[model samples]
Target: MTTAVDVLVVGAGPTGLTLALQAHDHGARVRIVERRPEAFRPSRALIMHPRTLEVLRPLGVTDALLEQADTAPKATLHLGSRAVEASLADLALPDTAFPHLSLVRQTDVERVLAQALADRGVAVERGTELVAVRDDGYGARAVLRTPKGPEVIRCLFVGGCDGPASTTRACAGIGWHGRPYTEEVVLADLDLSGTPGGSGAQLFAGRRGLLFLFPLGEQATWRLLATRASHGGPGPDFGQPGPPVPRSELQHLLGDAGLDARIERLAWSARVPLQFRLARRFRRGRLFLAGDAAHNYSPATGQGMNAGVQDAVNLGWKLGFAASRPHDSTGGRDAEVLLDSYDGERRPAACRRLFLTHTAFWAEASTGPTPSWLRAAAAARAAPLVPVILQRRRLVAEGVRVISQLRVNYRRSPLSVEETPHLHGAPRPGDRLPDATVGVGGPPQRLHALLARPGVHLLLQRDAAPPPHEVLGPHVTALRVANSPGRGLVAVRPDGHVGFRCGKVDAAGLSGWLSLICATGQPPGRPRPPDDAG
Candidate 1:
């Protein structure tokens, strides 16, 4: 039988699941399919950065993930006898509600996201594989092979969140252009004898290679990641076939790092050949690519899954806006423009992250004697200054800001419309609106919490009156704030970035921007102004 949906998601991993959930939340009919019959059982992508937590706040899963995850406020690095720790706490990010790194299994994250989708009446169609896709200008049709038989799905758009080997990307003729690293990395989950060094994640660097130990919340349970050289001599080539990493190998690496923890059990292990690749284009016709399908980077910084999730967050609302438009009206053109903006904004961000991860990997993975000696010497020289650096609040804050990805901006995006100079230190168009306490005495509420509602959020300063509802359209929500640093209005996009900012509320400007991005066939509905208490 031939079925139809507004959006057909090609994969059901974290990226695809997030896209499906957000698309459904935005009132789009989304159907997600996974080739795998069941969800992954093993845990991967353990760290959820602060920015990811903030972006996920509106999805209602952040709290659930926090409940199941562990927070690492400090990361300690041990080089010989010298130990330096970098604080991951939010001493720098006072505006954000979540200012620390969250350590949660990827399986748990998928479970939470999948349950949220189930609550919304959408279940992932397992064992449904996309065989082919064809775009005929207006919409796309996908050929899927289900357990029963082959079924055709006609949809307005196709989201390719199918990981590195993306069928959607190949069908769209997008090129995955990059190279893989020469060295291999082995990751394993281990049951340790006791606390390994400290509560937070620990890095042990030496002339051999680098080893990382991350606590998995439970007592004595930890995740270990080490370079091939760190496992004693050049380990098996990950590019070629390899055997399972033995438990003794893990123990030896731990011992080499000065850790005395005994491996009670080797729960799981895998050898991964790192790669840094990005798609040439994110969109082709009615097809869109996101997550690992769009870009793949080294996992050294633990950014692969987080970047993929953020990719979904960035593309989800855009897809929702496009799908909300009527097919017969001029909405098609506006939707195309909105969809095209995805590449402009997300590609650069992915490239930046890829560069950061690659640099970080080589910085710690280089096995050359000269580079290793230099790193060790630097660590030795800086050990005494670690206390002073941690004490200086400004330095620690700056470091946190960079690594947390709070500094990412899309000012170069064509969709970012900025006008008028700001008197207050409010964020500019394309910058993420810093989360802050938004309510009066009755317990502080976060800015993101106010944006739980779908669509573009128009945040009006305390003195500013709400604009006529008809001008903003149904997809736009206006919230009058009691305390705003800026005496103007800021239009926060679905992804939490500022879309439009002005010193005063410009209904005409807002309407123009909305008309371009959120064009629809229906007439403007009645204004649903938020309560004054907001």
Candidate 2:
């Protein structure tokens, strides 16, 4: 059997699901396939950072995630027996909605995304495996094995959202580089007897090693992470792959960490070898890699899933624009430029996150005697200053900003255009527009709510007159904003980032910029009649 679509997603994980949703929303015909027979059952990546929440807001899944997730606005670190608290309240970024870490099971996250895709009339084809992919200059073809028989799929673009061992990446000949961490880490979800005071997540550092406990919403259910250093094992080498650690061993480790909790029942457990790796390239012809398929990082920073979702969001709209060329007057040349921008923009972001997670893993998982002693000493010294430092609103805000990834920008990307010179302090092209309250009286609304619609958005100051519909084109949705920081008009991409910002509305310049990035050679939709000014 053979089928055709605008975009063929090779994996149905969070990354692929997100890509499908975004692409579908932008009018691209998308089909997603997953090798897994069913949805993931285990709770893998648990932390959803603020920036990820923002990126997903446009997809209409943020509300569902918020309902099912537990928000941790603060984090507690235990040094020996004493505990230090770090406030995450300051992370409530200036122009955004989400301000804290959302702790939810990875299964639930996937469930919500899958439902959203279903609502859009796209169902993930489970039990379908992509055996091969071939990308010619114009389009790509994928061969899949299904229960019935062999199936072939042809599409203009293919997204490799598969796991670290990605078939799409392998077929594309992209090289994965980097080494694995020497230590073996264990993760488990268990029910506990004793309870902690706050609902926030906790990290314990002791002579034995490091233990991180995250409350699972229930009375005493928690997710625990521990390193071999805390397991009383001999060195890093365990000789062979062993079964899950016994419940008795977990209880002992908890007791050593000064926790009064006792393990009631273990729901799940796994021993994993952490690795830090990135693909040599993210794009090859009509195929591109995202998520674990593109880069793999330590679980310490809890960024693996968030980064992958962002990758899909970044690539979805670009692929949509390229696929929509037939409706517009633009040729394949513009589509090529749009597709190439994906690799140029996303690779650097992944590199930055990889560096952060690597640094954090070593800092927390250092095992040698000297490193242990130094960590203890540093923790003791810093414990006293934590409260004082956290009390300063500015300091706390800055710390949260860095960790939340809200500062990530694509100012250097080819898609970003800054035509107006000397514009100071305002958001530049390629920067995410801060979520702010817009509209007046009737009710308060978020900027993202307006951007949730399909196509580019032209945000005009409340008092400013909107450009003629003919001048702006049907593809552009114009909205009037109240309390907007700056005058003039800002062109926001489908992904919710500022694409072009000008002091005043330049219909010609704005249209030209759109052509450059979106490949809409002529104004989209119905052509506007010539005005007296023109």
Candidate 3:
């Protein structure tokens, strides 16, 4: 069998599903193909940061997802013997109504996304693996292995969210660059009681290794992660099982450090390596990669999933915008440029995460046996700066009321322009819009509510009126504000970030800027303006 689609997504994980769902909502015919015969076993990624909640709310499922989660307002970080916590009670979450982390399993998230896609009339094919992928000038050709038989799929664009061993990436001949940790990590989901929330995170620093216990769902389950002994040089293959580590071992290792708890080992224990790798390229022709396919990092920061989801969110709109455009207007290059930017922007961010994770691993007490003297030294060293580091990490992790997602700035793109400061003006491409609750006044009943609707948003400052707002697809909204210094006519991307801004609320300037960055310099029906107009 053979099929044609506007976009063919090559993974069924959170990232791919997000892309699929968003593209479908934006009016594109899309299909998702996953190698696994079923929803992949839900393994990690339980923390849904505040920024994600903002994105999910716009999709109309934030409440439903929160129903399945335990909302925690703080994340604690333990440095040796001292534990300091960052409370979400005080974060400036941008563009979100709910600013907190939801502890929902990755499986639950995938299930939610899959259902959303289904409700929107998009189907995901399970057990359909892409064996070969080739891209020519016209489109992408993928040889797929379906349950019934072999098939070929032709798509205007392909998104690879296929995990670390991504065949799609390898087929594209992209090299993954990074280093792997010599230590192995043991992950266990165990039943627990009385773990404190907002008590922050617990870090055990011992000579043998480091053990961490994170609050999972009202203390019923705690995520226990530990680093393997480096001196032992990789213990018996993690595949084999051994008696639960003696309570004395836990005490000797981390128990004495601070955590007063017992391990009730359950039915599951698996060892995974701490490795960091990123694809040398984010895209190859019509084929593009996101999530673990594009990058992989240690679970230290719990960013693997969040980063992947962001990748999906970033690429989804671009693909949707490009795919839905008329061919005559795009000249066929629109899709390529929009798709190529996904890798260009996301790859560097992933690399930074990899480096940060490594730094965290090196700081672990498990790097070697904790000597009594070393523990004292660690506690002493942590007394000063550990608290600061812990706060930043916790804030980043929980992201409740924080700008984790919207904090990303894309101003460095070749598409951006430099602007000067003005009294009442538009925001620049990379600036984050301050949070404001606009009451029902303009066309839309509410302010952020207007964002829930489709199209780019241009918020103008007081005393500035945008030139007769032109209609372009579901694109561009112009609004006026009372006091927006250097933030007039702030153009926000569909995913909700300031994409283009003007100094004087110049309609032609705003339009020209939007045309350059948002639409790749082409306004649907408008003629190109003179160079100085910008």
Candidate 4:
């Protein structure tokens, strides 16, 4: 049978599910297919970075996810067996309401987002696979294999959220470009009985290799990851429950530092390489690649899953915008320029993440025979520099503040004026405002909420003319403020940001700003589902 939708998403994981939900909300018909018959029960990627939390707040899912899981706001580093804890609270992130990172399982987060979508009446198709994809200018066509039968689906666009060996990516003919890491690491989930030297995510390094313990839940369950032997037996497959590690191996791994813990449940295990790579191109005609399909990074910092989530957010609105306009003023359904921005912006950003993450892991786990005395001495000398390096590492390495979707600026966009004061300095139309307790509210509402109603927020100075305020109607808001530097008519995008800002609120500037965004603005990509009329 042949089916049709605005978007065909091939993967029911976090990235694919999110894209489908947002597209459906944007009034674009979407279908998601996953090879797995059901959602995984065990947790994966337990750390929910602050930035991902901030992105979910607007979607109305952050609170629910937090309720299901707990936060590990602090992570400790053990240098030469001595622990030095660093509170994520110390780091500064002006963009996000969630200034600190949270430790929540991937399964829990997926459940929350999935339930959110189901509540809105969208469901993902499981035990299905995207067998073939062919793009022919007007749209892309996909063939999916479901238990019932073979089905053909055609859409204006397709987003591949499938994992590294994505069939959709191959169908689109996108090529990967990077080398795999030499060392392989094994990760296993365990119900830990022994006490670790530190709480939160703990890092233990020695000549044997590096041991990383990530807190899962209740402080009893945790994840243990370490370098696997080059010539040892094959590592356990992640698809099945893993074999327990011998107490002797655990003793040898921990050495004199102390950690003879009994493990209860072995959820999953896998031999992972520290690999970094990106797809040559994100978009091929009407099809787009996102998450792991577009780029792959080391799991050392737990950024792989987070980066994929951001991809869906960035592309969702653009696809929604193009698909929403039944026909542009140009009498076409597609906006090539608008669609082009997805790859232009995201590719560079993803590449930077891959490079930084690789650098961090290499430094953290570099293996060579060094004397015990030398290692202890090095740790003492490196204490001061650790905090500074960690802070910058957390920020840029993780792209925590900006890439998390807090302070993204389209100021350099071809659709935007290449000139504006925000372009030259701090606090631009795109940069997220520092969390401030404005008025009676504590921590106040985000700057985004003020411009949430719709259209441009023309912050006119007290004496300036309001411009043709009527032309913007309910879509635009002209706020007259007193003594605010952020004043002056600022055109805000539908997604909530100052699209254009003028020194003074003038009719000409307002008109120009409105024209540019209207011609380019995209609505938030979330749909009310088919039966959401109630």
Against the true structure, whose TM-score is highest? 1
- The Cα local distance difference test for each model comes to 0.78, 0.76, 0.63, 0.63
lDDT of 3 by residue, 1-534 (tens): 376887889899888888787667655679899988887542567677666665554566667787777675455655554556556443444445554556677888888888888888887899999898888767888899999889987888888888887888988888988766666666555654456334644556555456776655222366666776533345442222223444444434445555655555443444555557788888888788888888876665567777788788778777777776556654355455556667767776676767766666666633544443454466556666755654574454443322245556667754344444433333466554445665334332335655665456656555455444352224555555543433344667766656655566565665555554346324354532211110
- Candidate 2 lDDT over 416-527, as tens digits, reads 8876632455589888888877663357777776677667777766444556554555456677666664457777887778888777766677767777665553534763
Kindly list the per-residue Cα lDDT of model 4 for residues 11-74, writing each as its tens digit.
8777887777666654567777888898965555767677666545556677888786555366
Among these predicted structures, which one has the highest lDDT? 1
Error (Å) of candidate 4 at residue 430 is 4.8
The stretch of ten residues in a row with the least summed lDDT in candidate 1 is 232-241
TM-score quality measure for candidate 2: 0.90
Badly placed stretches (over 4 Å) of model 3 are: 74-88, 92-99, 192-203, 215-220, 230-262, 328-330, 333-335, 365-376, 380-406, 418-426, 439-449, 469-471, 482-488, 505-507, 513-534
Query: Residue 401 in model 1: shift from native, Å?
Result: 2.4
TM-score for all predictions?
0.91, 0.90, 0.81, 0.81
Select the stronger candidate by lDDT from 1 and 4.
1
Name every residue pair that clashes in candidate 4.
24-527, 25-526, 25-527, 26-526, 26-527
Better of 1 and 4 by TM-score: 1
